[model samples]
Target: MTTLTVGSHRIDLSIPAVMTIVNVTPDSFYAGSRTASTETIAARVREAAAAGTSMLDVGGYSSRPGAEDVSPGEETRRLAAALEVIRREVPELPVSLDTFRAEVAERIIRDYGPCLINDITAGEADPSMFGTAARLGVPYIAMHMRGMPDNMQQLTDYRDITAEVCSYFEEKMQRLQEAGVQQVILDPGFGFAKTVEQNYELLARMHRLTGLGCPLLAGISRKSMIYKVLDTDPADALTGTTALHWECLRQGAAILRVHDTREAVQVVRLWRKFRENS
Candidate 1:
Protein backbone atom coordinates (compact mmCIF):
# COMPACT_ATOMS: atom_id res chain seq x y z
CA MET A 1 0.00 0.00 0.00
CA THR A 2 1.07 3.57 -0.65
CA THR A 3 0.81 6.59 1.64
CA LEU A 4 0.94 10.40 1.42
CA THR A 5 2.34 12.61 4.17
CA VAL A 6 1.47 16.29 4.45
CA GLY A 7 2.63 18.29 7.44
CA SER A 8 2.12 15.88 10.36
CA HIS A 9 -0.81 14.13 8.69
CA ARG A 10 -0.28 10.69 7.16
CA ILE A 11 -3.00 9.55 4.77
CA ASP A 12 -3.21 5.84 4.08
CA LEU A 13 -3.54 4.80 0.44
CA SER A 14 -5.14 1.44 1.22
CA ILE A 15 -8.48 3.26 1.17
CA PRO A 16 -9.31 6.26 -0.96
CA ALA A 17 -9.54 9.64 0.82
CA VAL A 18 -11.49 12.82 0.05
CA MET A 19 -9.94 16.18 -0.82
CA THR A 20 -12.57 18.88 -0.35
CA ILE A 21 -12.61 21.69 -2.89
CA VAL A 22 -12.51 25.29 -1.57
CA ASN A 23 -12.69 27.54 -4.61
CA VAL A 24 -12.18 31.13 -3.44
CA THR A 25 -12.89 32.71 -6.79
CA PRO A 26 -16.10 33.65 -8.59
CA ASP A 27 -14.91 32.56 -12.01
CA SER A 28 -14.90 28.77 -11.35
CA PHE A 29 -17.03 27.00 -13.94
CA TYR A 30 -19.15 25.44 -11.22
CA ALA A 31 -21.17 28.30 -9.75
CA GLY A 32 -22.06 26.42 -6.56
CA SER A 33 -18.44 26.35 -5.34
CA ARG A 34 -17.53 29.92 -6.24
CA THR A 35 -17.05 32.25 -3.27
CA ALA A 36 -14.59 35.16 -3.05
CA SER A 37 -15.08 36.08 0.56
CA THR A 38 -12.69 34.83 3.24
CA GLU A 39 -15.38 34.28 5.86
CA THR A 40 -17.49 32.10 3.56
CA ILE A 41 -14.43 30.23 2.40
CA ALA A 42 -13.37 29.47 5.97
CA ALA A 43 -16.89 28.37 6.85
CA ARG A 44 -16.82 25.92 3.95
CA VAL A 45 -13.40 24.65 5.03
CA ARG A 46 -14.58 24.25 8.60
CA GLU A 47 -17.62 22.37 7.37
CA ALA A 48 -15.46 20.04 5.31
CA ALA A 49 -13.14 19.43 8.24
CA ALA A 50 -16.04 18.77 10.53
CA ALA A 51 -17.47 16.39 7.95
CA GLY A 52 -14.14 14.47 7.90
CA THR A 53 -12.39 15.63 4.75
CA SER A 54 -8.87 14.17 4.69
CA MET A 55 -7.46 17.19 2.88
CA LEU A 56 -8.68 20.70 2.11
CA ASP A 57 -7.70 22.07 -1.33
CA VAL A 58 -8.02 25.87 -1.39
CA GLY A 59 -7.73 27.57 -4.78
CA GLY A 60 -7.44 31.32 -5.18
CA TYR A 61 -7.60 31.54 -8.97
CA SER A 62 -10.06 29.47 -10.94
CA SER A 63 -8.55 27.34 -13.68
CA ARG A 64 -11.79 26.99 -15.60
CA PRO A 65 -11.53 27.41 -19.36
CA GLY A 66 -11.72 31.03 -20.50
CA ALA A 67 -11.29 31.99 -16.83
CA GLU A 68 -10.35 35.61 -16.42
CA ASP A 69 -6.71 35.82 -15.40
CA VAL A 70 -5.79 37.17 -11.97
CA SER A 71 -2.53 38.94 -11.40
CA PRO A 72 0.07 37.31 -9.14
CA GLY A 73 -0.43 40.02 -6.54
CA GLU A 74 -4.18 39.41 -6.49
CA GLU A 75 -3.73 35.65 -6.29
CA THR A 76 -1.27 36.02 -3.41
CA ARG A 77 -3.61 38.36 -1.62
CA ARG A 78 -6.61 36.07 -1.91
CA LEU A 79 -4.69 32.86 -1.14
CA ALA A 80 -3.00 34.34 1.89
CA ALA A 81 -6.28 35.61 3.29
CA ALA A 82 -8.20 32.38 2.72
CA LEU A 83 -5.37 30.23 4.05
CA GLU A 84 -4.99 32.40 7.12
CA VAL A 85 -8.67 32.03 7.89
CA ILE A 86 -8.65 28.25 7.50
CA ARG A 87 -5.44 27.95 9.48
CA ARG A 88 -6.86 29.90 12.37
CA GLU A 89 -10.22 28.07 12.41
CA VAL A 90 -8.82 24.56 11.96
CA PRO A 91 -5.22 24.52 13.03
CA GLU A 92 -4.57 20.86 12.22
CA LEU A 93 -6.24 20.77 8.83
CA PRO A 94 -3.85 20.16 5.92
CA VAL A 95 -4.20 23.07 3.43
CA SER A 96 -3.20 22.86 -0.22
CA LEU A 97 -2.65 25.82 -2.54
CA ASP A 98 -4.16 25.42 -6.01
CA THR A 99 -1.90 27.75 -7.95
CA PHE A 100 0.55 27.63 -10.85
CA ARG A 101 2.58 30.72 -10.05
CA ALA A 102 5.98 30.00 -8.50
CA GLU A 103 5.91 33.28 -6.63
CA VAL A 104 2.53 32.41 -5.17
CA ALA A 105 3.79 29.00 -4.05
CA GLU A 106 6.93 30.50 -2.56
CA ARG A 107 5.03 33.27 -0.81
CA ILE A 108 2.54 30.83 0.74
CA ILE A 109 5.31 28.58 1.99
CA ARG A 110 7.23 31.53 3.39
CA ASP A 111 4.15 32.93 5.09
CA TYR A 112 2.42 29.72 6.15
CA GLY A 113 4.44 26.96 7.81
CA PRO A 114 4.27 24.13 5.20
CA CYS A 115 1.42 23.57 2.74
CA LEU A 116 0.94 21.27 -0.25
CA ILE A 117 1.22 22.77 -3.76
CA ASN A 118 -1.53 21.74 -6.17
CA ASP A 119 -0.56 23.31 -9.49
CA ILE A 120 -2.85 22.86 -12.49
CA THR A 121 0.02 23.72 -14.83
CA ALA A 122 2.24 20.77 -13.68
CA GLY A 123 5.26 23.08 -13.80
CA GLU A 124 4.60 23.85 -17.46
CA ALA A 125 3.50 27.45 -16.92
CA ASP A 126 6.31 28.26 -14.52
CA PRO A 127 9.44 26.12 -14.61
CA SER A 128 10.53 27.30 -11.20
CA MET A 129 7.44 25.79 -9.52
CA PHE A 130 9.02 22.33 -9.11
CA GLY A 131 12.21 23.77 -7.67
CA THR A 132 10.20 25.81 -5.24
CA ALA A 133 8.09 22.82 -4.18
CA ALA A 134 11.29 20.86 -3.63
CA ARG A 135 12.84 23.71 -1.67
CA LEU A 136 9.84 23.99 0.60
CA GLY A 137 9.63 20.18 1.05
CA VAL A 138 5.91 19.97 0.34
CA PRO A 139 3.70 17.51 -1.51
CA TYR A 140 3.03 18.52 -5.13
CA ILE A 141 -0.10 17.80 -7.15
CA ALA A 142 1.12 17.72 -10.76
CA MET A 143 -1.89 17.65 -13.04
CA HIS A 144 -1.94 17.01 -16.79
CA MET A 145 -3.40 19.86 -18.84
CA ARG A 146 -2.83 20.17 -22.56
CA GLY A 147 -2.87 23.95 -22.60
CA MET A 148 -3.67 27.02 -20.54
CA PRO A 149 -7.19 27.25 -19.17
CA ASP A 150 -8.28 30.04 -21.51
CA ASN A 151 -7.32 28.02 -24.63
CA MET A 152 -7.65 24.44 -23.32
CA GLN A 153 -11.13 23.78 -24.62
CA GLN A 154 -9.95 24.76 -28.08
CA LEU A 155 -7.27 22.05 -27.99
CA THR A 156 -9.38 19.02 -27.19
CA ASP A 157 -8.60 17.08 -30.34
CA TYR A 158 -6.23 14.55 -28.87
CA ARG A 159 -5.75 11.48 -31.05
CA ASP A 160 -5.03 9.23 -28.05
CA ILE A 161 -5.78 10.79 -24.70
CA THR A 162 -4.25 8.08 -22.52
CA ALA A 163 -1.06 7.75 -24.49
CA GLU A 164 -0.54 11.48 -24.74
CA VAL A 165 -1.30 11.99 -21.06
CA CYS A 166 1.07 9.21 -20.01
CA SER A 167 3.81 10.66 -22.20
CA TYR A 168 3.19 14.09 -20.75
CA PHE A 169 3.44 12.75 -17.20
CA GLU A 170 6.61 10.88 -18.04
CA GLU A 171 8.35 14.05 -19.16
CA LYS A 172 6.89 16.13 -16.37
CA MET A 173 7.97 13.62 -13.71
CA GLN A 174 11.47 13.60 -15.09
CA ARG A 175 11.74 17.39 -14.91
CA LEU A 176 10.23 17.55 -11.41
CA GLN A 177 12.54 14.79 -10.11
CA GLU A 178 15.50 16.55 -11.64
CA ALA A 179 14.49 19.63 -9.70
CA GLY A 180 14.58 17.51 -6.49
CA VAL A 181 10.81 17.41 -5.88
CA GLN A 182 10.27 14.87 -3.08
CA GLN A 183 6.59 13.91 -3.08
CA VAL A 184 4.46 13.96 -6.25
CA ILE A 185 0.76 13.41 -6.98
CA LEU A 186 -0.61 12.89 -10.49
CA ASP A 187 -3.95 14.30 -11.72
CA PRO A 188 -5.38 13.48 -15.16
CA GLY A 189 -7.32 16.79 -15.43
CA PHE A 190 -10.70 15.24 -16.33
CA GLY A 191 -12.48 18.11 -18.14
CA PHE A 192 -9.86 20.77 -18.60
CA ALA A 193 -9.41 20.00 -22.31
CA LYS A 194 -11.40 16.86 -23.11
CA THR A 195 -14.58 16.15 -25.01
CA VAL A 196 -17.41 14.40 -23.21
CA GLU A 197 -16.52 11.13 -24.91
CA GLN A 198 -12.83 11.67 -24.25
CA ASN A 199 -13.50 12.33 -20.61
CA TYR A 200 -15.31 9.00 -20.23
CA GLU A 201 -12.61 7.31 -22.22
CA LEU A 202 -9.99 8.70 -19.87
CA LEU A 203 -11.95 7.53 -16.87
CA ALA A 204 -12.34 4.08 -18.40
CA ARG A 205 -8.64 3.90 -19.07
CA MET A 206 -7.41 5.67 -15.92
CA HIS A 207 -5.73 2.57 -14.51
CA ARG A 208 -3.24 2.72 -17.38
CA LEU A 209 -1.68 5.83 -15.86
CA THR A 210 -0.39 3.90 -12.85
CA GLY A 211 2.67 3.02 -14.91
CA LEU A 212 4.04 6.39 -13.78
CA GLY A 213 4.55 4.98 -10.26
CA CYS A 214 2.82 7.87 -8.44
CA PRO A 215 -0.34 8.26 -6.41
CA LEU A 216 -3.41 9.19 -8.53
CA LEU A 217 -5.64 12.18 -7.74
CA ALA A 218 -9.05 12.27 -9.47
CA GLY A 219 -11.09 15.56 -9.61
CA ILE A 220 -14.22 14.49 -11.51
CA SER A 221 -16.79 15.98 -9.15
CA ARG A 222 -19.74 17.64 -10.91
CA LYS A 223 -17.70 18.46 -14.01
CA SER A 224 -19.34 18.91 -17.41
CA MET A 225 -18.61 15.31 -18.27
CA ILE A 226 -21.26 14.20 -15.79
CA TYR A 227 -23.71 17.10 -16.06
CA LYS A 228 -23.58 17.23 -19.84
CA VAL A 229 -23.95 13.48 -20.13
CA LEU A 230 -26.82 13.36 -17.62
CA ASP A 231 -28.64 16.25 -19.30
CA THR A 232 -28.37 18.21 -16.07
CA ASP A 233 -26.44 21.05 -14.47
CA PRO A 234 -23.48 21.07 -12.05
CA ALA A 235 -25.75 21.49 -9.05
CA ASP A 236 -27.80 18.46 -10.18
CA ALA A 237 -24.89 16.16 -10.86
CA LEU A 238 -24.16 15.04 -7.27
CA THR A 239 -25.60 11.56 -7.72
CA GLY A 240 -23.77 11.06 -10.97
CA THR A 241 -20.63 12.42 -9.35
CA THR A 242 -20.86 9.96 -6.44
CA ALA A 243 -21.53 7.12 -8.87
CA LEU A 244 -18.38 7.97 -10.81
CA HIS A 245 -16.27 8.36 -7.69
CA TRP A 246 -16.83 4.65 -7.00
CA GLU A 247 -15.38 3.69 -10.35
CA CYS A 248 -12.48 6.08 -9.80
CA LEU A 249 -11.64 4.59 -6.39
CA ARG A 250 -11.86 1.10 -7.83
CA GLN A 251 -9.46 2.10 -10.55
CA GLY A 252 -6.76 3.00 -7.98
CA ALA A 253 -7.48 6.69 -7.41
CA ALA A 254 -5.81 7.49 -4.09
CA ILE A 255 -7.38 10.92 -3.73
CA LEU A 256 -10.82 12.22 -4.76
CA ARG A 257 -11.14 16.02 -5.03
CA VAL A 258 -14.78 16.75 -4.62
CA HIS A 259 -17.29 19.51 -3.79
CA ASP A 260 -19.31 17.47 -1.25
CA THR A 261 -17.19 16.43 1.70
CA ARG A 262 -19.78 14.49 3.72
CA GLU A 263 -20.96 12.48 0.76
CA ALA A 264 -17.43 11.72 -0.35
CA VAL A 265 -16.37 10.77 3.16
CA GLN A 266 -19.32 8.42 3.35
CA VAL A 267 -18.46 7.03 -0.03
CA VAL A 268 -14.97 6.27 1.20
CA ARG A 269 -16.34 4.78 4.40
CA LEU A 270 -18.72 2.36 2.65
CA TRP A 271 -16.21 1.58 -0.05
CA ARG A 272 -13.66 0.62 2.56
CA LYS A 273 -16.19 -1.55 4.38
CA PHE A 274 -17.10 -3.33 1.16
CA ARG A 275 -13.46 -3.66 0.20
CA GLU A 276 -12.61 -5.12 3.58
CA ASN A 277 -15.44 -7.62 3.44
CA SER A 278 -14.43 -8.69 -0.01
Candidate 2:
Protein backbone atom coordinates (compact mmCIF):
# COMPACT_ATOMS: atom_id res chain seq x y z
CA MET A 1 0.00 0.00 0.00
CA THR A 2 1.23 3.50 -0.82
CA THR A 3 0.99 6.34 1.66
CA LEU A 4 1.56 10.14 1.54
CA THR A 5 3.19 11.76 4.54
CA VAL A 6 2.58 15.52 4.99
CA GLY A 7 4.20 16.72 8.15
CA SER A 8 3.14 14.15 10.76
CA HIS A 9 0.01 13.13 8.86
CA ARG A 10 0.24 9.81 7.07
CA ILE A 11 -2.48 9.30 4.45
CA ASP A 12 -3.13 5.65 3.67
CA LEU A 13 -3.52 5.00 -0.05
CA SER A 14 -4.60 1.36 0.18
CA ILE A 15 -8.03 2.75 -0.69
CA PRO A 16 -8.89 5.85 -2.74
CA ALA A 17 -9.03 9.21 -0.97
CA VAL A 18 -10.83 12.49 -1.74
CA MET A 19 -9.15 15.92 -1.73
CA THR A 20 -11.67 18.74 -1.73
CA ILE A 21 -10.97 21.97 -3.64
CA VAL A 22 -11.24 25.27 -1.78
CA ASN A 23 -10.41 28.12 -4.15
CA VAL A 24 -9.78 31.48 -2.54
CA THR A 25 -9.63 33.28 -5.87
CA PRO A 26 -12.62 34.97 -7.50
CA ASP A 27 -11.61 34.12 -11.08
CA SER A 28 -11.48 30.33 -10.80
CA PHE A 29 -13.19 28.56 -13.69
CA TYR A 30 -15.82 27.20 -11.38
CA ALA A 31 -17.58 30.08 -9.73
CA GLY A 32 -19.09 27.95 -6.99
CA SER A 33 -15.60 26.88 -5.89
CA ARG A 34 -14.40 30.43 -5.30
CA THR A 35 -14.61 31.53 -1.68
CA ALA A 36 -14.58 35.31 -1.50
CA SER A 37 -13.70 35.67 2.16
CA THR A 38 -12.11 33.83 5.03
CA GLU A 39 -15.52 33.26 6.62
CA THR A 40 -16.72 31.57 3.44
CA ILE A 41 -13.58 29.46 3.25
CA ALA A 42 -13.96 28.40 6.87
CA ALA A 43 -17.55 27.37 6.24
CA ARG A 44 -16.56 25.48 3.09
CA VAL A 45 -13.76 23.69 4.96
CA ARG A 46 -16.18 22.55 7.65
CA GLU A 47 -18.64 21.36 5.02
CA ALA A 48 -15.98 19.45 3.11
CA ALA A 49 -14.62 17.83 6.29
CA ALA A 50 -18.14 16.74 7.23
CA ALA A 51 -18.65 15.45 3.71
CA GLY A 52 -15.72 13.01 4.21
CA THR A 53 -12.86 14.67 2.35
CA SER A 54 -9.50 13.26 3.48
CA MET A 55 -7.73 16.51 2.59
CA LEU A 56 -8.35 20.11 1.57
CA ASP A 57 -6.53 21.89 -1.29
CA VAL A 58 -6.55 25.67 -1.02
CA GLY A 59 -5.37 27.78 -3.90
CA GLY A 60 -5.11 31.57 -4.00
CA TYR A 61 -3.80 31.91 -7.53
CA SER A 62 -6.14 30.70 -10.23
CA SER A 63 -4.48 28.23 -12.59
CA ARG A 64 -7.30 28.33 -15.07
CA PRO A 65 -6.03 29.04 -18.60
CA GLY A 66 -5.63 32.76 -19.42
CA ALA A 67 -6.07 33.70 -15.77
CA GLU A 68 -4.63 37.10 -14.90
CA ASP A 69 -1.43 36.68 -12.98
CA VAL A 70 -1.38 38.10 -9.48
CA SER A 71 1.70 39.37 -7.71
CA PRO A 72 3.39 36.93 -5.33
CA GLY A 73 2.69 39.27 -2.45
CA GLU A 74 -1.02 39.29 -3.27
CA GLU A 75 -1.09 35.56 -3.67
CA THR A 76 0.66 35.08 -0.36
CA ARG A 77 -1.72 37.46 1.36
CA ARG A 78 -4.73 35.59 0.01
CA LEU A 79 -3.32 32.20 0.96
CA ALA A 80 -2.40 33.46 4.43
CA ALA A 81 -6.03 34.36 5.10
CA ALA A 82 -7.26 30.96 4.02
CA LEU A 83 -4.54 29.18 5.99
CA GLU A 84 -5.42 31.12 9.09
CA VAL A 85 -9.01 29.94 8.79
CA ILE A 86 -7.91 26.36 8.22
CA ARG A 87 -5.65 26.41 11.25
CA ARG A 88 -8.29 27.99 13.42
CA GLU A 89 -11.23 25.82 12.38
CA VAL A 90 -9.75 22.49 11.31
CA PRO A 91 -6.19 22.30 12.53
CA GLU A 92 -6.09 18.51 12.31
CA LEU A 93 -7.20 18.25 8.69
CA PRO A 94 -4.28 17.79 6.30
CA VAL A 95 -4.05 20.78 3.93
CA SER A 96 -2.43 21.09 0.50
CA LEU A 97 -1.30 24.51 -0.76
CA ASP A 98 -1.76 24.75 -4.55
CA THR A 99 0.81 27.03 -6.18
CA PHE A 100 3.79 26.65 -8.45
CA ARG A 101 5.74 29.68 -7.13
CA ALA A 102 8.67 28.73 -4.93
CA GLU A 103 8.28 31.93 -2.96
CA VAL A 104 4.72 31.04 -2.00
CA ALA A 105 5.66 27.45 -1.17
CA GLU A 106 8.60 28.55 0.98
CA ARG A 107 6.60 31.17 2.82
CA ILE A 108 3.69 28.83 3.49
CA ILE A 109 5.94 26.11 4.87
CA ARG A 110 7.81 28.62 6.99
CA ASP A 111 4.59 30.02 8.46
CA TYR A 112 2.32 26.97 8.43
CA GLY A 113 4.81 24.12 8.95
CA PRO A 114 4.72 21.27 6.43
CA CYS A 115 1.47 21.49 4.50
CA LEU A 116 1.52 19.62 1.18
CA ILE A 117 2.69 21.62 -1.88
CA ASN A 118 0.64 21.09 -5.05
CA ASP A 119 2.71 22.52 -7.92
CA ILE A 120 0.94 22.61 -11.24
CA THR A 121 4.15 23.35 -13.13
CA ALA A 122 6.02 20.29 -11.75
CA GLY A 123 8.96 22.55 -10.77
CA GLU A 124 9.39 23.88 -14.28
CA ALA A 125 7.76 27.21 -13.46
CA ASP A 126 10.02 27.97 -10.52
CA PRO A 127 13.49 26.43 -10.33
CA SER A 128 13.64 26.67 -6.55
CA MET A 129 10.38 24.70 -6.00
CA PHE A 130 11.94 21.23 -5.73
CA GLY A 131 14.64 22.47 -3.38
CA THR A 132 12.09 24.32 -1.28
CA ALA A 133 9.89 21.26 -0.99
CA ALA A 134 12.88 19.13 -0.13
CA ARG A 135 14.00 21.51 2.57
CA LEU A 136 10.51 21.69 4.10
CA GLY A 137 10.15 17.89 4.07
CA VAL A 138 6.49 17.93 3.00
CA PRO A 139 4.61 15.83 0.50
CA TYR A 140 4.80 17.36 -3.00
CA ILE A 141 2.22 17.00 -5.76
CA ALA A 142 3.81 17.55 -9.18
CA MET A 143 1.31 17.96 -11.99
CA HIS A 144 2.27 17.53 -15.66
CA MET A 145 1.80 20.72 -17.64
CA ARG A 146 3.67 21.90 -20.70
CA GLY A 147 3.79 25.58 -19.84
CA MET A 148 2.33 28.36 -17.72
CA PRO A 149 -1.44 28.82 -17.58
CA ASP A 150 -1.34 31.96 -19.73
CA ASN A 151 -0.28 29.97 -22.82
CA MET A 152 -0.16 26.29 -21.99
CA GLN A 153 -2.78 25.43 -24.58
CA GLN A 154 -0.41 26.47 -27.34
CA LEU A 155 2.31 24.16 -26.00
CA THR A 156 0.41 20.85 -26.26
CA ASP A 157 2.19 19.19 -29.17
CA TYR A 158 3.06 15.72 -27.96
CA ARG A 159 3.71 12.60 -30.06
CA ASP A 160 2.25 10.26 -27.46
CA ILE A 161 0.59 11.99 -24.52
CA THR A 162 0.87 9.12 -22.10
CA ALA A 163 4.43 8.22 -22.97
CA GLU A 164 5.44 11.85 -22.87
CA VAL A 165 3.76 12.37 -19.51
CA CYS A 166 5.40 9.24 -18.14
CA SER A 167 8.77 10.39 -19.36
CA TYR A 168 8.21 13.80 -17.82
CA PHE A 169 7.47 12.17 -14.50
CA GLU A 170 10.44 9.84 -14.77
CA GLU A 171 12.77 12.76 -15.31
CA LYS A 172 11.16 15.01 -12.70
CA MET A 173 11.02 12.20 -10.14
CA GLN A 174 14.73 11.57 -10.53
CA ARG A 175 15.51 15.25 -9.99
CA LEU A 176 13.18 15.42 -6.99
CA GLN A 177 14.69 12.30 -5.43
CA GLU A 178 18.13 13.73 -5.99
CA ALA A 179 16.98 16.86 -4.21
CA GLY A 180 15.91 14.71 -1.22
CA VAL A 181 12.19 15.32 -1.78
CA GLN A 182 10.26 12.23 -0.76
CA GLN A 183 6.51 11.44 -0.68
CA VAL A 184 5.65 12.65 -4.17
CA ILE A 185 2.22 12.48 -5.80
CA LEU A 186 1.61 12.62 -9.55
CA ASP A 187 -1.31 14.53 -11.11
CA PRO A 188 -1.96 14.22 -14.89
CA GLY A 189 -3.34 17.76 -15.02
CA PHE A 190 -6.60 17.01 -16.81
CA GLY A 191 -7.14 20.23 -18.79
CA PHE A 192 -3.98 22.26 -18.41
CA ALA A 193 -2.40 21.89 -21.81
CA LYS A 194 -4.23 18.97 -23.43
CA THR A 195 -7.11 19.14 -25.85
CA VAL A 196 -10.38 17.45 -24.93
CA GLU A 197 -9.44 14.35 -26.95
CA GLN A 198 -5.95 14.28 -25.45
CA ASN A 199 -7.38 14.58 -21.95
CA TYR A 200 -9.57 11.54 -22.59
CA GLU A 201 -6.59 9.66 -24.03
CA LEU A 202 -4.53 10.39 -20.95
CA LEU A 203 -7.39 9.32 -18.70
CA ALA A 204 -7.75 6.11 -20.70
CA ARG A 205 -4.07 5.34 -20.17
CA MET A 206 -3.80 6.78 -16.66
CA HIS A 207 -2.87 3.37 -15.31
CA ARG A 208 0.43 3.62 -17.14
CA LEU A 209 1.42 6.40 -14.78
CA THR A 210 1.28 4.14 -11.74
CA GLY A 211 4.69 2.80 -12.80
CA LEU A 212 6.18 6.13 -11.65
CA GLY A 213 6.01 4.75 -8.10
CA CYS A 214 3.91 7.60 -6.70
CA PRO A 215 0.26 7.89 -5.80
CA LEU A 216 -1.87 9.16 -8.74
CA LEU A 217 -4.30 12.03 -8.23
CA ALA A 218 -7.07 12.54 -10.83
CA GLY A 219 -8.57 16.07 -10.77
CA ILE A 220 -11.33 15.71 -13.36
CA SER A 221 -14.12 17.31 -11.42
CA ARG A 222 -16.38 19.39 -13.73
CA LYS A 223 -13.51 20.18 -16.04
CA SER A 224 -13.81 21.06 -19.73
CA MET A 225 -13.20 17.46 -20.72
CA ILE A 226 -16.44 16.57 -19.03
CA TYR A 227 -18.60 19.63 -19.74
CA LYS A 228 -17.48 20.06 -23.33
CA VAL A 229 -17.85 16.39 -24.21
CA LEU A 230 -21.27 16.26 -22.58
CA ASP A 231 -22.47 19.52 -24.22
CA THR A 232 -23.24 21.00 -20.83
CA ASP A 233 -21.98 23.53 -18.32
CA PRO A 234 -19.83 22.85 -15.26
CA ALA A 235 -22.78 23.09 -12.87
CA ASP A 236 -24.50 20.34 -14.88
CA ALA A 237 -21.37 18.22 -15.33
CA LEU A 238 -21.54 16.36 -12.02
CA THR A 239 -23.05 13.25 -13.58
CA GLY A 240 -20.34 13.13 -16.23
CA THR A 241 -17.67 13.84 -13.63
CA THR A 242 -18.88 10.99 -11.45
CA ALA A 243 -18.95 8.63 -14.41
CA LEU A 244 -15.34 9.43 -15.39
CA HIS A 245 -14.27 9.30 -11.76
CA TRP A 246 -15.21 5.60 -11.71
CA GLU A 247 -13.01 5.07 -14.74
CA CYS A 248 -10.18 6.95 -13.02
CA LEU A 249 -10.43 4.62 -10.02
CA ARG A 250 -10.48 1.59 -12.30
CA GLN A 251 -7.33 2.92 -13.97
CA GLY A 252 -5.46 3.09 -10.61
CA ALA A 253 -5.96 6.64 -9.34
CA ALA A 254 -5.37 6.75 -5.58
CA ILE A 255 -6.69 10.25 -4.98
CA LEU A 256 -9.62 12.18 -6.48
CA ARG A 257 -9.40 15.98 -6.24
CA VAL A 258 -12.92 17.28 -6.68
CA HIS A 259 -15.30 20.12 -5.99
CA ASP A 260 -18.12 17.85 -4.89
CA THR A 261 -16.78 16.27 -1.73
CA ARG A 262 -19.74 14.06 -0.80
CA GLU A 263 -20.10 12.52 -4.24
CA ALA A 264 -16.33 11.99 -4.54
CA VAL A 265 -16.23 10.27 -1.14
CA GLN A 266 -19.11 8.06 -2.23
CA VAL A 267 -17.29 7.22 -5.47
CA VAL A 268 -14.16 6.24 -3.52
CA ARG A 269 -16.21 4.03 -1.21
CA LEU A 270 -17.99 2.28 -4.07
CA TRP A 271 -14.74 1.86 -6.01
CA ARG A 272 -13.10 0.28 -2.97
CA LYS A 273 -15.99 -2.13 -2.59
CA PHE A 274 -15.83 -3.07 -6.26
CA ARG A 275 -12.11 -3.70 -6.03
CA GLU A 276 -12.52 -5.79 -2.90
CA ASN A 277 -15.27 -7.88 -4.46
CA SER A 278 -13.47 -8.28 -7.78
Residue 194, model 1, lDDT = 86
Off by over 4 Å in 2: none
Error of 1 at 144 (Å): 0.8
- lDDT of candidate 1 at residue 258, scale 0 to 100: 98
lDDT of 2 by residue, 7-116 (tens): 87778888789999999998999998999797899899999988988899999999888788899999999889998899889887899999989999789778987799
Model 2 RMSD in Å is 1.0
After TM-score superposition, what is the CA distance of residue 109 in candidate 2 from its true location, in Å?
A: 1.6
The residue-by-residue lDDT of candidate 1 on 1-278, one tens digit each, is: 38777778787776687899988887887888876887788788889889998888888898876678899999999888887888798877788899999999889878987888999989889988999999888899999887898888888988899999999999998988899988899999999888999989999999999878999999999999999989999999999999999999888899999999999999888889989899
Per-residue lDDT of 150 in model 2? 87
Query: What is the TM-score of candidate 2?
Result: 0.98
Clashing pairs counted in every model = 0, 0
Candidate 1 local accuracy as lDDT?
A: 0.88
The pairs that clash in candidate 1 are none
